[model samples]
Target: MFGRPQLVFLLLLLVAGLAWLRLPGDEQRVRTALIMGTLVEIRLAGDPQQFNPAIDAAFAEMSRVEKLFSSQLAESDVSQLSFSTEPFQVTEESAALLQRGRQIARQSDGAFDMSLGALKQLWGVETENPQVPSAEQLQQALAGVGPEALQIEGRTVSKSNPHLQIDLGGIAKGYAVDRALEILRRAGVTSAAVNAGGDIGLLGSREDGKPWRIGIQHPRKQDELLTTLILTDRAVVTSGDYERFFEKDGVRYHHIFDPRSGYPARDCQSVTVVAADVASADALATAAFVLGPQQGLQLLEQLPQVEGLLVAADGTLHRTSGLAALEP
Candidate 1:
């Protein structure tokens, strides 16, 4: 679901002496809450006084979106729809997300089903006592996960099955980043990056007008980089098993579940997707992980705007031809 070690390293790097080492004119620094169903770091750089207000407004807007999409909050629109029998109406932003979810579900052959909320609860991935769900529970969840069960009409969300639940965990954060970036750009912030966990959306370039250099971490090695790429106004998102998991007997169960089996898909070690936007990258990364390394590469080739980097379970690296040219 995320690159845990990479994310931790980035957090540590931010606070460990790196904050004081700034370029000649790149002295601006502002901190804001990054919305990902929880508050995380959203650091901005530029002229502190002027940039501070824009950063604050962007984060405030993101927070408002978080409340709309979060499933953890019992009062959220997503949560209310999970239990409601009637068609749940949503705002334009939410409706757009639902439409994107359905499009990915269709394109990924149900590999990226948004209707996995019930399955997620059964596994308790966010709970303190995470364990394997019972057979009965898995069966009930499986019954509710088919993409056909979901229906989106204008601004209303409905399901053919009342028990069907939708979870936007795979796409929400990236969507939020895109929304935030739009706000930042509108505020005249040209050089910026919005990193929602490992999903990053870059704008223009770094302060020196150079493309932002980002590394793709090696799945098997903690401190190694599989490859690095230069990005400008693009989004990078990784879907992997390393983020959260627990072992049952000898088998390791991760948070990313396959809707078909109500269990984690096990073919690829990780899938990193780079796209024109964060939401697309986020959705495609999850889909690529489910598609496995070979098919995932094929899928990326077919997509005109999406490129992918896949790490197989056997420690092999796979990417599109264009990506090979960009890889370092």
Candidate 2:
């Protein structure tokens, strides 16, 4: 879901080091905290005193969501639901996210699945020591890997197979970003940016009355940018093979797995999605990465408020017509 040190480095370079616009006004109130296993940054342009509290409130909202959605946490709704044999009732937040994930999985033709928890555990992609699972192990994991296994009815969810587990790494952070933005808006913040690692949600313009400039990190190059975008009131998210991966005898094994193959998605090197909401952008980026270039762009075309940029394995770049128009 998140790249490690490299992701942190790229975020610092883009959010802090890179200057977007600085104008005479209240000092930019910025707060950064470690949440959702990554850095979450919130920046507001307003009276420092008033906006500072708003920033604090926003971080609190993020933390609250993290506790509710984190699969790693024992007390989280996701964890409890995973361990339950009977129907598990969940919070409205959890139910909504799960329902949304199911819709995306169906739309992507199972290219992106929420029921891949067993497969992830078998491959050990989230651990420091990731190893390739044997064919037998892969088969066993695949038995519990399908969106149909999990059933959601209102605020209660149940799984036909007890082994079926759900992991929200792909969409949870973006949902948190949206929730944080809601908090900021309620606090009267009209112009702000909430960045969770590479998934970002923005509102209004910068202090200089200019659109916020965001640099897209090069998929294959470190400390280099493929392009920059000028955006306002939009969410931009990127999912890349470079984020989390391990190498075995010169072959790289990444975290983005193809539901059909039970292996890392090799169609695209990286994918960037821009949409009106962070959750949609984040989920679509992952789905597009699995679908590769042609199908990925086609999916974006069908989406009304979405556009995408896909970097293929051959180093060719592809973009939706809408995204191409926004390229700086």
The candidate that achieves the highest lDDT relative to the unseen native structure = 2
How would you encode candidate 1's per-residue C-alpha lDDT over 242-326 as one tens digit per residue? 8778888999899888777778889888899999999889988998898888887888778887888998888788888788766
Model 1: runs farther than 4 Å from truth? 1-34, 37-45
lDDT of each: 0.81, 0.86
TM-score of each candidate structure, all chains considered together: 0.89, 0.90
Error of 1 at 208 (Å): 0.7
> Candidate 1: how many backbone clashes?
0
Which candidate has the top score in TM-score? 2
Q: State model 1's lDDT.
A: 0.81
Error of 2 at 309 (Å): 0.2
Q: Write the per-residue lDDT of candidate 2 for residues 1-328, one digit (tens) a residue.
A: 3459888878877775345343433245677899988999888887777888888888899999999988889899988988888999999889999899888888887777887877888788769889998888888887767667678999989987887777888899999999999988898988999999999999877866899998999999888998888899899999999998899999999999998888899989999999999988998899999999998888888999898889999989998998867777
Note the residue pairs that clash in candidate 2: none
